[model samples]
Target: MQSNTVDVFTIGFTQSNAERFFNRLEKAGVRTVIDVRLHNTSQLAAFAKADDLAFFLQKINNIRYVHQPLLAPTDAMLKAYKKEKGDWGVYEGRFLDLMGERKIEQRLKPEMFEGACLLCSEALPHHCHRRLVCEYLNDKWNGALSVRHL
Candidate 1:
């Protein structure tokens, strides 16, 4: 099936409090939350911890929460970026390769983006894997979906 346009949103909660974070998603009318973090259960997540976030999404707005760990960068890859001060270009290339190897483009259901949002921990899309994921998807999916970074 071909979609005229798929609205895939992206967001991160680093600089946001729980209320504002969830509020943004709610206001956007997000029906699904695709957690693209390697460690969704980290204590640093506050209210966005795996179980709690899933609970809250359903309880607050009937939004579905999905943990797509495969979408996350590997620990080694992330270490190279943060701990080793790796070049953004290198990181981007590596991450893109990983996504292709995972065949995520083929596996992803276009219907899922009807009212779905991609999630990560960064405050903004710059230098974030979430942004790369959206860009890759937008291109590979033949522009069926346009990403809106929230």
Candidate 2:
């Protein structure tokens, strides 16, 4: 690990199977998985259910799992984007504002993100808050964080 560089990874479980997901994390040498999902307990993905994911992560790869709801968008915000067909630009603006208002950069420790993977439901980071979170933190920390999407 570089003294001045903090490496962070991001991933989405959607369109991924248990084998591929776990293997990817293991291959990436992830030490922890920080779930950034608003509704993690949903039945959408059985293996990704909060309890099951934690258990699987530990049992399969010995990786620590944490659910950090503060990293997720609010239910209303998500609803507007998904259910109401709101524009991505609007959603992005609102989410970024909310993160600033919540002061996640101050509340979340940079050390915790070292060797950690941010987990979301999107198959790709393009439209995911996980990507925005990484960019936001990198900006706040003066590009100290090196983010890699897996």
Candidate 3:
């Protein structure tokens, strides 16, 4: 293997049922699920509720769960993006800027991503910050991690 080639994954539960979601992670050999959301307990989230997910992941799949709010966009940023009619390009730009300011490179380590999956609500990666998180980490880690959007 190369010097540091960590395996990182990203998954969204919007289009997936609880069973399918857990299946995906298990199939991918995911050991950790890093939740990148501002609020993980939203009613719309249902079974994916932070505490419930944590328990289910561990009990059912043996996957550890961690919520990293720093990876989520601020409420203000989210509001602005929605106000723009879901312009993904603008949201991407603004989110990237926020990530830079947060110095995500320094804050997150390759170890935190090894066999880990980034979780969010967007069914597709196109409009999700989890995709950006993967891209940003892939670049910052100098290709040290392989990111797969599940």
Scored by TM-score, the top model is: 2
Backbone clashes in each candidate structure, one number apiece? 0, 0, 0
Tell me the tens digit of each residue's lDDT in model 1 across 43-144.
776788999999999998899999999899999998999899999999999999999999888998667788899999889999999998888877887777
Clashing pairs in 2: none
TM-scores of the candidates are 0.93, 0.97, 0.93
lDDT of 3 by residue, 1-150 (tens): 475688889999887788889898999999999999998996666779999999999999999999999999998878878665777787899999999999999998888788899999989898899999888877887888887888
- Provide the global lDDT of candidate 1 against the true structure: 0.89
Give the lowest summed-lDDT range of ten residues in model 2. Answer: 1-10
Candidate 2 Cα deviation (angstroms), residue 8: 0.6
Error of 2 at 101 (Å): 0.1
Clashing pairs in 1: none
Off by over 4 Å in 3: 1-3
Predicted candidate 2 versus true structure: per-residue lDDT over 96-149, tens digit per residue: 999999999999877879999999999999999999999988888788788999
TM-score of 3: 0.93
Show model 2 residue runs off by greater than 4 Å. Answer: 1-3
As a whole number from 0 to 100, the lDDT of residue 90 in candidate 1 is 97
